[model samples]
Target: MPLMRIQLDSDRQTARRVVELHRTGKVHRESRDAARAEVWRRGRTPAGETVFVGTTNGEPVRLIYDVEVYRDVTA
Candidate 1:
């Protein structure tokens, strides 16, 4: 699977919410528009920023906030 890295600069609350939603399987619900938007995992940087890891699966998806995005080629 292709991995994606989403870095939330300063929005810790949103990042926490995203992680929680994914943990509860709400983000992967088929009834939602973001059906393919599944957060595989999450972590924190040394600087205290929240980072989310997910897969594109070749489908387009959107995030809640305007943040930096990168393709995790190493994964």
Candidate 2:
């Protein structure tokens, strides 16, 4: 198993949300943060935090993902 690192901008709230999303099969953390950031940008909350989902190391169908929860925009 490879070690996956999820990069976040020190936002615990976003991190938690990502964790929940991953748990419920809402998204995957396979794609790199660079690629996933685009998707996350689309799902920005009112707090301006972008939630990215990506898969880590697992299997083709069942892969574990790390959420790169961060704030892409600021008010």
Candidate 3:
């Protein structure tokens, strides 16, 4: 299925931890996808969203992406 990024949260350390887990094979949850060695530590809300907690500046404060997700496509 086609997926889209709807939300990102950089307000908590849990967010960073989730992102690290997404890119690397370190930590994970049973509800998470396990098809690959490393998993994308992201999840969809009951409202139907794809959230991500990614970092850019290599710092906790630098990682901030509290947003939302959806199945909408852009042109």
Q: Of the candidates shown, which would achieve the greatest TM-score relative to the real structure?
A: 2
Tell me the number of clashing residue pairs for each predicted model.
0, 6, 12
Q: Write the per-residue lDDT of candidate 1 for residues 1-75, one digit (tens) a residue.
A: 233344323244444566578677655233122222323233311222223353232223333322232434454
Worst 10 residues of 1 by lDDT: 28-37
Q: lDDT for every model?
A: 0.36, 0.41, 0.40
Error of 3 at 59 (Å): 13
lDDT of 2 by residue, 8-75 (tens): 34244444555677678664343334434543565732323224444333223222234333455568
**Residue 45 shift from truth in candidate 1, angstroms:** 29
RMSD (CA, Å), candidate 3 to true, equals 9.5
Relative to the true structure, candidate 3 reaches a TM of: 0.28
Report the CA-based lDDT of candidate 1 relative to the real structure. 0.36
Off by over 4 Å in 1: 1-10, 28-75
Residue 71 accuracy (lDDT) in model 1: 38
Of 1 and 3, which scores higher on TM-score? 1
> lDDT winner among the candidates?
2
Candidate 2 displacement at residue 53 in angstroms = 9.4
Q: Which stretches of candidate 3 lie above 4 Å from their native place?
A: 26-75
Tally clashes: model 1.
0
